[model samples]
Structures are given as C-alpha cells and as structure tokens.
Target chain A: MHTDVVHNEQSMTPHPAGSARHPQAGGRSPRRMTPARRREHLINTALRLYSQQSLEDVSIDDIVTTADVSRALFYRYFTNIRDVHVAALSTVVDELIGRLTLPPDGDFRQQLHHTLAEFVTFVETYATSYTALLRSGSTIATSTTDTLVDRVRDHVVDLFRERLGHSSSSPMLERTLRGWIAVVETTLLSWLQHTDLPREQLETWLTDQLLAMITTTAQHDPTAAEQIRHLLAESGDEP
Target chain B: MHTDVVHNEQSMTPHPAGSARHPQAGGRSPRRMTPARRREHLINTALRLYSQQSLEDVSIDDIVTTADVSRALFYRYFTNIRDVHVAALSTVVDELIGRLTLPPDGDFRQQLHHTLAEFVTFVETYATSYTALLRSGSTIATSTTDTLVDRVRDHVVDLFRERLGHSSSSPMLERTLRGWIAVVETTLLSWLQHTDLPREQLETWLTDQLLAMITTTAQHDPTAAEQIRHLLAESGDEP
Candidate 1:
C-alpha cells in the first residue's frame, strides 16, 4: 500500500500524451468511441474544468464526470489530466500560428507588428488555458505548439534574409535568424510571466521594443545595415 | 485496500516518501535527524534516484533505503515526494539565480552578451537536473515556479534600468527589459529541450543571437538608441 502511494506521487508530473486511448467497455453500456472523438471530448471537458481550479487540483474523477464518461473511457482518451490539457491548449496555439504569417508586401516593421498583435490576441482570447499551460510547462510537448513557434521564427528569419539580399552568405543568414528567434521567444515568455497588462498595450509595447532591437543590431553590423537599408528602399520607407 | 491504492497513486505522483513505513519501536532505531539535515538528505537522495529513472519510477522504498531514514521522518520534512523534489530543484534554481547578476561597465551588446553567457554557463553546469525539473512539471507547483520566475524577471528589469539609465517610469525601459528577459528564457528552455547539440556551440550561438536582438531593438527607440550610442561611444567605437 505504502509503495503504491509513493509510486503515484512520483508519476504525477504533467507530461505530453503521446498516444490517444480508445474507448473501453464497462462504462455505461460501452458505447463505441473513436480515439479522435474521445480525445476531443476529454480536452474540451478538461479545459472547462481547469479554468475554475489550479490544473493540479482537477482530478481524473472530475474530468470523467465532466465529460460524462467512465473512468475507463477517460483513460481511453488520455493517459492523464495533463494530456487533455495539452490537447485543449494546442488548439488555441494552432489558431495563433495560422494568423501569424508574414505579410507579402509589408516592411519588416509592419510584418513584426502584425505578428505581435496576432500573438497578443491569441493569448487574450485564451488567457486561462494559455496561463495554465505556460505555468505548468505541459504545452512544451505539443507538436503543433512547437511548430507554430518554429514557423514564426522561420518567418522572421526569412524577412531578415530578404532584407540582407546579396550582402551575406549562408552563415550570416543562419546567425541572424537564430538571434532573432532567441530574442523574440525570450521576450514573449518574460511578458507572459510578468504583468497581466491588457493585450493592446502589451502588443504595442512589444512591437516597438522588437523593432528597436532589430534596427540597432543592423546599424552595428555594416553588412546587416546595408541589407536593412536596401530592404527599406525596396519597401519605399523614408530614409 | 482499494481506497489506499487510489490515495497512494494520487499522492505518489508527488511524494515517494509516503511509501515508507513508520518503524515500530523495535523494528528499527529512529535516527535523531535535524529538520534541515533531513530535508537536505532527502533532496540529495531523490536527485540521485530521480536522475536514474523517470520521476514516476522512483518509489518511497527507493528514497527511504537510500536516505537511511524512516518513513515518518520523511513525512515530517515534506508533505509528499513532489514537495521534496520541488524543494531540491528550488535549491538548484536559486543557485542559478545567484549567479545571474549583470556585469558592470560594458556596452549594451557586451553587457547583454555577458549576462547571456552567465545563463548558458548555469544551464550547462546543471543540465541534467535542469532538464529533469523542466520535464517533470507534475512535481512542481505552477504558482511557486511562477513566483520564482517573476523574481528573476524583476532582477533583469533592474539591470536594464541601471545600465540604460532609464527611469522605472519610462515605458520603453520596461518594455525593452521585459521583452529581453522573455526572449532569454524561451531560448534557454528550447536549448535545454534539444540536448543533442554541444553546450559550447549552443552557448556561443545564444550569446551572439541575444546581442543581435538587443542591438536591433535598441536602434528603434530614441531613448534606447541614445543609450546604445553612448555605450558604444564610451567603449571607443567610432560612430
């Protein structure tokens, strides 16, 4: 008995669910359920419950009851509560990623502002789930979430690459892209951790701050500076 | 027994020490361990044990035998095994924090590079334990970890204010500092997750990337731009 308790405590950390469980028998007539439907049901139910309590406070029983499913059914959909939470949160992250594409014609500043606003809007719309996932670090494993972030990083790098044009080689492009991604991720996470400041204010502030960093760095790197100016000219920005 | 098993599994997710049996008076002589010493012992033992297995795999029997302490003694020090893990992990985080002070007298790029290098060094030194803490979100309380992260953010903010000579009331200072910290944390977490890369290469890449971000961001804002220019001038860089 004692050993069981110890084992349970050790396994409790929320992890990304790698596999979807299939509905099982012995719960309310054993209606057949597909893995996709079961996963969706569990995630929606868990998201609703998590909004009301600490993610840690919600139990398997609460989730099963809320989903109107048996314990076996719950297990069929997710390995644990955290798995459901990740699935629910990934939906919102996916939406944000969809909205953050690079504008075909905008200058770097405009594109950056658009991306920043999209991110803030997503965070605002799903504040509770976003907060829960960020706080728990459970969102780290969701491939969709990672893909969204990576895509944004790639877009930013591409913008810098286009700006650089004929001024740099493969190495410079890699370095610039990597640096931009690191800065953007660090800044976003810090803001998420700190103030619950309203979305518009945060977005504006971040947009301006990011632009400032990009400009200053470019000025110091002669090659990067030439690229920025060329891109600015191409985009018809006032010198 | 069933109820015990449920309770054991639920609690075990956080506390492995719960599995230890309170020794009968004649079963084993209880060691006269101080509270602080016992906690240290438990944390050290758990770290060693946890590193060897998934956080879920280490049992109370594993901890008790390793620590040579009774179950009752373990409970006295921690509410559960998760508490012990958090306490242990907190020590490591605190050590990292202690080493994160910003250096005096350098250009914005140089200062930013130094601070980032410090972070990389800390992460490299505690890579295994750090990765474990990040992976096992189950054992650590979200609120507690957020509070710790907030402290680190404030420290970074203060450094920005001091170095940039910007008042706390300045919105640009707040935005720039907050954004930089966010980028740093996100980059570090991502790097931590990708363990295949060499630490030295990763650190160098991170440092160069962060400096670029800071430099770029500095140029967009008049006040920040001025600060960067002054910093560069002080460092004998020709405008």
Candidate 2:
C-alpha cells in the first residue's frame, strides 16, 4: 500500500522552467504579475503539459513557453519546477483532505468509507498527474507526501484520542490508529495502481478493515472493551 | 512509518574507490571486472559519496573517479547514477528479505515480534544508506522502492498463504496479507524517522500492531476464522 506513490504523482510534474519564466525579461515598464496569479497560471499550464506527456519528458523550457512567463520571474516565485508541482499538489491534497469530513457523530465504518471514497475519487480523477508526481520523487515531492501523511496521521490519531478520551495515550489506541492509517495508505496506493476495483468495493473493504482494527481486542486492554463499545456506539455503530 | 527509509539506506552506498582504483591512468591491461563485482564497486562508491553530500551534489564524474571505472563501463552497468543506486538498493532488500525467518511453530505474537525485530535491526544497521537512497524522488528511486516493496510483499504473502493454506486467489486472505504488510511498512518507516524511540521499544510497538491486525477478523470471513486459528496454533498460541 504505497500512498507515497499517489502523493509522489502530484509532486513531480511541471519542470521548473515554467516558474522561472514568470518575471518579465528586461523590465521596460514591466506589467506586474501578482504572485498568486502567476502561480495559478504556472500550475494550470503545467497540468495541461503534464497531462500530455511524462514528467521527465517535459522540460522547464516547455513549461515557460507554455505558461508565457520569463525564467527569472518563474524563479522569483518557485525554487524549482518541482517546487511548483509540489505547490500544485499541496493545493489538491489540501482540498482532498478538507473533503474528508469525519462526522463528529457517525459510525467509524461509515466515516472510514466516506473518507476512502473521497480519496479514491480524487486520485482517480487526477490519475495522470498523480502518477507523474509519484514517479518524480524529488525532495519537494517527498516533503509534500510527508506533510500529507503527517496531517492524516494527526487527524486519525486525534479522532481516536477523542473517542478514547483520557486513554488516548494508551499504546493500544495508538497502535490501532497507526494500523488503520497504514492499511488505508496501502489500500489507496494499490487501488491507484490498479484502478479496476470499483470505488465502493475498495471503500467497503477498507472500512471493514479499519473497523476491525478499532473494535478488536488483540492489543487493547480487557478493561477498555466497554470503552471501545461506547466509543463505537457514539460513532453510530450498533455493536 | 517509513521502513522504505531504512531499506533505502542499506542499499544506496557506493563502494570506496580508493581501494578499487587502478594506480595507472593509462589503460595498462584492464582488469576484467565481473558484472557483479562492478555493481558492488559502484554501490559502495555511490553510498560513500552520497553520505558525504546530497544526490544532486554528487556527480557522475565523482562516482567514476571513485569507482576507478571508465565512464563507458559505468553506462554499460547502469542507465545512470540513479540506476546504480537502485540496483544497490535491490541487492540490500533482497538480502534483508532472505534473512527474515518466520518460525513455523511459534505463537502468533512471538512470530510477529521475532520478524518485526529482525526487520527493525536490518533497517537500523543500514539507516544511513537507506536515507541517501530515498532522499530523492526520482523515477529510478521510486521504481527501486516499488521493486523492494513488491519483493517483501510477495515473500510475506507467500508465508501467510502457506500457513493459512489459502489459494493464491483468495481475496480475503490477499487483502489480509496486504493490510498486514501496509501496517508493518508504515510502522517501520515511522520508527525509522522517530529517533526518540528506542529500536527495541519501536519493534515491540510494531509487533503489537501487527498482531492486532492479523488476529482480528476485519478482512477474513468466518470460514477463514478456522484458518486463522490454525495460524495462531502453529505459532504456539492457544486459539
């Protein structure tokens, strides 16, 4: 389950040349290109170029030419083309993560399903760029992935911690959250690699796995059984 | 958890060129370097150089100078420096996988702990090289990671399938294996990154997580429960 690959895809496209071309050359009454607008233009152009070819196949020259920006301006805004790609990816990830709503009051299974479904849809919709980003594996790309994983880990850990209350620090709860995140990342990556699996089927499969990790007593203390039950119920699970 | 990082460290180091370098610059009777020996030389030199500097910081000239190999020979052996690094990585991963011994008759908990400990130790030993290997998100690096992952996944899945006596096509069992692998990989990676935790402590934590995932019934059907029980029993756990 290599979610790293999914994150990787978003980080690797759009060679830095596009961003480098942003600043007006030989500034004679230079038209001011706002940073935000320049970024958008670069990303949109890069996406279009990335969709048509491999990341390695695309050069910085190609992106600058496509985006109609000066090399100096591009550098002014981005450290490199990879940075631009990562910035684009960060936007997508932020959007995707935002969409993953953990209802303050839904069954853990349902919540897991919703989250997985949303993630799968995002990856599928952006498959080409995603794959390109993953294949690139630049420092910026990896850092973006690390950021995503860290954010997701913190989110899931918080959810479990909230449910577990004071017992949140318990090793068992920590293990459970970590295990679920691991499975989720892996399942997402596998699905991305092999998109033949129906979204619902993948979601259902992941939901069951996550629910089992949360509810089972393999590593949980015997005393926490009731607590687990109460937490599950609060999350809308009957059992 | 980024066990990928650990694996990356073990394989990316290039051999020391000082020992391998030929004294004379002029081609005085070129020593016939076997493909295997040449690969070893390249890996060792690359790892050594990469350790001192970033991947981008290191050049092909640096590697060739250190390896005492002709540029043409280097090309013959690898598409680029990254290719050499990946090959080095694959070798280390294959070795680690080979060393993993799953006791046929230990308790489920014990077997898991034993395997997890072995894996952690392998990663810790090669931590530096793995860091170098995975630092960049190049296509070659990602592909190398995929190959390493596929190898580990195949080995673990086969081990579990044999224990469960499940057909290769069993969806439930397959998912179970994949989930377990995901959890393990994630935990290991986390452990690698978080130096605050002791290796033994981290391994124990990971073992507990893996046991919870395997012993739980999230992905398996009731019919498969018996097989799970058998697995536990074979591992010396009373089901």
Candidate 3:
C-alpha cells in the first residue's frame, strides 16, 4: 500500500518540446506573463502531473521542469511541493462544488441522480489525485489536505439538507445522511481501484444506498420518519 | 480538527505510586521481570497513557516516566514513540478481533447484535486511541499504523463472509458489505465524539443499515438476491 512511485531525480534531461510531459512546451523561449497568470500556470502544471500519478510521486523538480520555469521562480510562488499540492487540490474542490448544483425544481430522485452523476464524473476526472488525497498515511497527507476532503463531504451533506427543505434535520436523519455519504466515498474509492461495475450502475446503486439508509432509519426513529415522509412521497418511494 | 492536546513535556515529575497513570507503580525500587514481561509492561504503559489522551499527546518521556523505567531502557525495548504506539494498537486490534466471534448456531440477527455489542464495548474501552488511529492525517500516522487499522476492517469483513457461509461472494454483495462497514466506522467515529444516541440503538441501527444495503443491492443484482435470500429469510426480514 505504501508503493510510492519515485521518479528518477538524477536525470536532468528535460523532455523535448511538445512532449506529453511538457504539454505547453517551448524551446527555452522567454515567454512573459503576469505574476497571477504565472502562478496559475504553475498550479496547472502540478495538477497535470497529479493527473498522471499520485501527489507523493510528483516533486518540485518535476513541477519546475514541466512548467519550463526556474526552481527559484517556483519557490517564489510556492514554498514547497505540499504548498502547491494543497493549492491545486483546493482548486479541484472548488470546481467540484461549483459543478454540483441542483435546480431545486425537479423530482427528488432525478435531482439526486444528476448530482451523483456530476460527482462521479469529477471523481473520474481526478482519479489519481482523488485517491492520493483521500488515502490515509500518504507521505503528502496534511491537515489542510484532510480539511479539503472534509469540505467536499460537508458540501454534499449541506446540499442534501437544502434539497430536503429542512431548516434542521433530526439526529437520525443527519446520521443516516452522513453514514450514506461515507458509503459513497468508500464505494467510489473501491470503484476507482477496480471498476468492476459500469459507471451508471455505480451511480444508481449509490443513490439507492442513500434512500435505503433513510428508509431504514425511518423504521427506527419516528422523528426521521415524519421529516422524510414528504421526501419519500416526492420521490414515489413508499418506505 | 487538528487539535492535538500536547502534554507538558518539561514537567519530568512522575505520578505517585498507585496513581492512575501507573497502575503498577513502584517507589523507585528495582523490580524483577523477564525481558518479554518488560516489553509487555512498556506496551501496557503506553496503552494506559493512550486511554487518557490521544496518541499524539503522549511522548517518550511520558511513557518512560510513567512506566518507572529509564529512557535508556525504553529505547532498548522500542525504537521510539511510534514503535510503542504501533505495538499498543496492534494489541488493541488483536483484542477486538478475538472478542468479535459469532456463534455459528444462532439466529443471524441475534448473532449480529451480540457481535456488535462486543465491538461497541471495545471501542468504548479504547475510545481515545481508536479515534486517533482512525482519524486521517494525524501527526503520528504511518503506513504501518494505517495497515493495523485496515487489519481491523478486513477482520470484520472476513467475519461477515464466514457467517454468510459464502466461499466467494458476488461483486455486488462484497461491495455492499464493504460499504456498510464504512458506514459503521464513520457512524461510530461520530458517535464517539458525540454520545447523542444510546449504544443499543447504535448497534441495532448499524445492523439494519447492513440489511438495508443488502436488500437494496438485491433489487439491482440478481446474484446478490440469490446469495442473501437465506440470510434475510433466517432473520425474518421480507426484504
């Protein structure tokens, strides 16, 4: 499980221009851009490398070489590899949250289905980094990175609450929602590793898992049953 | 979220004999014990300290002083604090696995309830260290420690498989079980932080949560439906 792929750092030979490693390859030309644009470019370079491999495998040298910038410039923008990793992951979290909006006027099932689809697409897009960011005991694991992951989970829970139109959820309802969220995360992590089932099946199964949790919770807690009765009614799920 | 309660390391004063910190306290008298016994003593000392606070808060000095041993002796038995922490947690994992046995001749629901009761008891006994071990990105988090945590999860899954009498489970059944296991973990972690619900309710809700997952999976996968038919039937659950 601790198989961190270490790229060869002894070799100083840069990839040829236009190669896959250096997508925006240039022949050592003095291309000029504003400081903000340059910082974003560096972050983008780090993200592209993260896409190919775990954050533990990417290094400062890799980032600078791929960005076609000096080590000094890289340090000037970000203090270390972890700094850039956090910034890049924060960007990913922002993109994910921005893409997860429900229109608030559709059937509950359809809205949940669409939201889960978008979430799945985001996870697929950032598979490697998503795995690295969530995997416990990674060398690059930090409090900030963990907080970013929590932010995503909290966002999903808040979205669920908003859709249910409840000012405050009963304890049973909250725990049921949180428990379902954990199931989704663990299932997605496993799916990313094996992908034994089709993506649509995974999506639909996760949706069903949440509804199942809510239904089961309702059986035990009258408050939850009362609060989510309308939810079951709206979705035509007689539980 | 990263509030690691650091103890005052500068205070080298050891607790009085027979105090809580040193259950086997002695008044500076050289005690005789075998090498294996000595190592076990050190491990127990770490566990005692862990029960009082998170692993992050306990230090080498704390362990040595509490155990009534010199720093040199502490080093002789273990490499460092993390070495002792890992050994202590492995002891916990062993105890948890040993206690989670299900009688092979009882009703499935009763068996599950008994096993979950034992699990809840163990978690309550080792609340602080269990939380620390499962929390992501802790300062003391290591691949070895993380593997110990995984060992517990794998043991639980194996127990389920044995009880289900399946030589090999279908993909849907395995995934459903794993996802429910995650829910149990997350729900317990939250429950530990806030004891808002009764312990019996927690155990029963978790049992129902697994049944719910299995039932929902059955609706989508015929293989799972066929595999768990006897399980649901024996438990007198229509779904």
Candidate 4:
C-alpha cells in the first residue's frame, strides 16, 4: 500500500498535470460504464490530455490507452481523432460560456473584474488547450475548432450587450467590444506563455484596458459616447 | 493589338486583383532571362497569384503557367509550392518592414498616424496574402510562414523600443506594446473581412488605441508611467 501511494504521488498532486509520468494509465473501469458514460469518459480523457500537452500530440490511441479502453471502443463513440477533438473543444467552450457571468449586484467595474477573473480562471484550468486553440498555424486547427473559438467571442459580445441594456449593437460599439476582446485574448495568451506579471495585476490591467478603449471610442463616436454615459450613470461611476 | 487590349483589360485595372479573370496568363516570358532574374520573376508571379487568390489555391502549375515558364524551369528554383510561398512571404515582410518609417519631422501622434497609414497601405496591397498568412488555420500555413509573421512583430517591438530611446524593454512596456500590436493585427484582419470602417478612421483609431493602452499601463507600472511621461513631454502632448 505504501509503495502504491508512492507510485501514485504524481497523480495525487493537484496541479501541474504535465508532471504525471503515466497520464493515461489505469484510471477507469472500461466494461462497467454505459455507452454514454464511456463517451463522456473518453472526452474527459482527451481534454485532460490536451490540457497537459499540445493538442496536435493527443491522438485517438492516446485517448483510448489513457482511458483503459480498446481502440474499437473509442471509435464506437467518435468516428476519428478530430471528431473527439471537436467534441472535447465544444465541451470546453460550453463550460467557459456557462461560467462567465457579470453579477447584478456589484458595480460595473467590480462586475467586470469578477467576470474577467472568472475568464482567467477558466484559461488557467485549460492553459495548454486554450493556447493550442487560439495560437494560429497549429497543425491540428480545423474549421470546426475555429468555429468553437468564434462562438466564445460571439457569446461574450452578446453578454456585454445584454448587460449594458442594449437591444442591439451599433457598429462602433460592436467593433470596439470585439477589438477589446482581441486584446483580452492576446494579453492572456502572452500572459500564459511567460507568466511574468501577477494574475491579479493582469486581470486588473485587462479590465482597465476595456474601460480605456470604451473611453477612447466615446471621443469619436457619439453613439459610443452616449452609451458609455448611460453605462457610467448606471454604475454610479464617472467616465 | 486592339483585341489584345480588350483581353488584357482585366489586368489593366488599377485595383482589385481579384477581378482579373486570368491572373496567371501571359505575364512573363520563359527562358529569356538570366537564372537569377528568372527566379525573381517566378517569385513575383507567385506573389501576384497569392495577392489575387487564397494561398492554398495557388499551385506549382499555376506559378509556372502565370510566369509562362515550363514545369522543368519551375523545379529548378523551388522544390515545391510551399517553398515559393515562404519566399514570396519573406519578400512581402521585407517590403513592409522597410517601408515602415516613423518620420522625424512630425509630432508623435502625426508620425504614428502616418506610420499606421503606411501599414494599412501594405495590408491593402497584399490583402489576400496578408490575410492568408495571418489567419490562424490555413492548411497551407507552415512553421516557416508563422516565423515570418513573428519576424514582423519582433521588428515592430524593436522599432518601438528604439523610438522610445530605450535600449531594452521592461516587462510592462514590452507586454503593453506587444498587446497593442496584437490589437492591430486582429483589428486589421477583421477590417479586411468586413471593411465597414473607413481607412482614415481605422488608422486614427489604431493609433489612439496604443496611446490609451500606454496611459492605462502607466497607472499600474512605474516604468511605463515614466516612459510615457518622457514620451509625451518630447511630443508636447498630454498622457
């Protein structure tokens, strides 16, 4: 039992999934699971693998082997590796979108900070996968994967519009929001790579960047200026 | 010759490379030049083809046909289509980097506006190729292509540092500048796709976005604050 504990120490550690020596070894009972459960298990395994390594390096064989299942069982659920990848990525996207919420009770800046912190958390949880998905020119990137990423951006745009009590977005508002989203992404990507700045500072800096962008846009675009005025009034803050 | 004029009318248009029905026909003579000139002619043809269409669609046959050269001659210079693509992209990068000059005579804002306008012009000139190279998941994207893009970014960072009178960059300044560079890329890619905003507005907006970013960073980073203070003082502008 002591030897088993020593052997499993790597897996027992809560962080640094990359440090696991046998990430795909002996985690599940293959025959006990229903088909749906098995499929979920496979996807979870794939996502776990992706979070620890490059998405291009995670193969069907690795997924099955890690799940302690036969290759036949793996194909029974997903047609191919890319299918599994797409499915796993969709799961991640859904989780990210679902978890992002700007609480109603807080001031706008506080809400924005909390929402961005949530985003940073999600990014941290799936650092490798998020990087692989967003980094251009990855060999494994497909249209399906690209669409999943777009879905997140589109959802965030909608969320912001709804929060601001706007029925629809003007071109200036839309472009400014989308541009800020890109800034968030690029900043997070760089942050993930180097981790030079503290997370709290990065989060606050990102929040401030959006405010700055909106303030800048307001100077040129009357619609943006009016919307920002209303937004600031609602938050009881000065623009 | 008059009939030929009608046939060549598509190519004669001042803009819209995409409108040319035959982008790769009768542009150059085969076997008439020295080997060095012939190789350059082929690369130029490949770039022209890329400018007009998706890089993935431009093939070895297309290059040879456009240059009016034989397959044998094409093989002498390039091992494959991708080789020519890398070469063509390098030329574009070199031209863009070379042409980007922050002239010494203007206020900082004016100089920045002019430099950005030049960049936008380069983007317009190689719109298709630039999109193809930077768009994340083109099947034709290779490590060489990705590296070429990075070279442009790195050069821009160095350019900014030199302009700021900093021999080296602090972490805050580096990240802010790099983040702003990303905003430019993402904004340009979106603009290229939708083109709703006018070129003048886009240029001014991008220039302002960097200013806003620097101001925001100054609040959190002493190094950035000091640098921006110095920068603004030099330009007789407020931060």
Top-TM-score structure, candidate number: 3
Candidate 4 shows a clash count of: 0
Q: Show where candidate 3 strays beyond 4 Å.
A: A1-30, B1-23, B26-30
The digit string of per-residue lDDT tens for model 3 on A123-230 reads 887888888878788887788998998998888878877876787788878988888878888888999999899999898999888888899899999988888888
Error of 3 at A98 (Å): 0.7
Q: What TM-scores do the predictions have?
A: 0.58, 0.64, 0.89, 0.87
Give the poorly placed runs of model 4, Cα more than 4 Å off.
Answer: A1-28, A234-239, B1-30, B234-237
Fnat for candidate 1 (0 to 1)? 0.24
| Residue lDDT tens for model 2, B1-239 | 21221111233333332434433223332345456655665666675565555544567788788656679878887897667667666766777787777886666677767777787766666655555444334334565566675787788777667656665534554666787776766555555676655766566656654544555542345554666776566554332
lDDT by residue (tens digit), candidate 1, B1-239:
11211111111121222234323112432354445555665775675565556555566777787766678877887887667666766765666667677776666556766777887766555555555444324444345655555666677777766775665524444655565555555556666666545665555544544444444445545665566566556544423
lDDT of 4 by residue, A1-239 (tens): 11122112222112325545443355444455556666777777787787778878898888777777789888799898889888888887887888887787877778888989999988898888888888877766777788888898898888888877887866777788788888889888989989988999998888888888877788778887887787666555455
Give candidate 1 misplaced runs (Cα > 4 Å): A1-94, A107-112, A127-129, A137-239, B1-33, B47-62, B102-115, B134-141, B162-169, B192-232, B235-239
lDDT of 1: 0.54
Task: List, for all models, the DockQ compared with the true complex.
Answer: 0.14, 0.25, 0.64, 0.55
Ranking by lDDT: 3, 4, 2, 1
Q: Which digits, one per residue and each the tens of the lDDT, describe model 4 over residues B1-239?
A: 11221112222122225445444355535345566666767777787777778888899998777777689989999999888888888877887788787788876778788888888988988888888888777776767888898888888888788778888867787888888888888888889999988899989888888888888888889887887687666555466
Native-referenced Cα lDDT, model 3: 0.79
**Complex DockQ, candidate 2:** 0.25
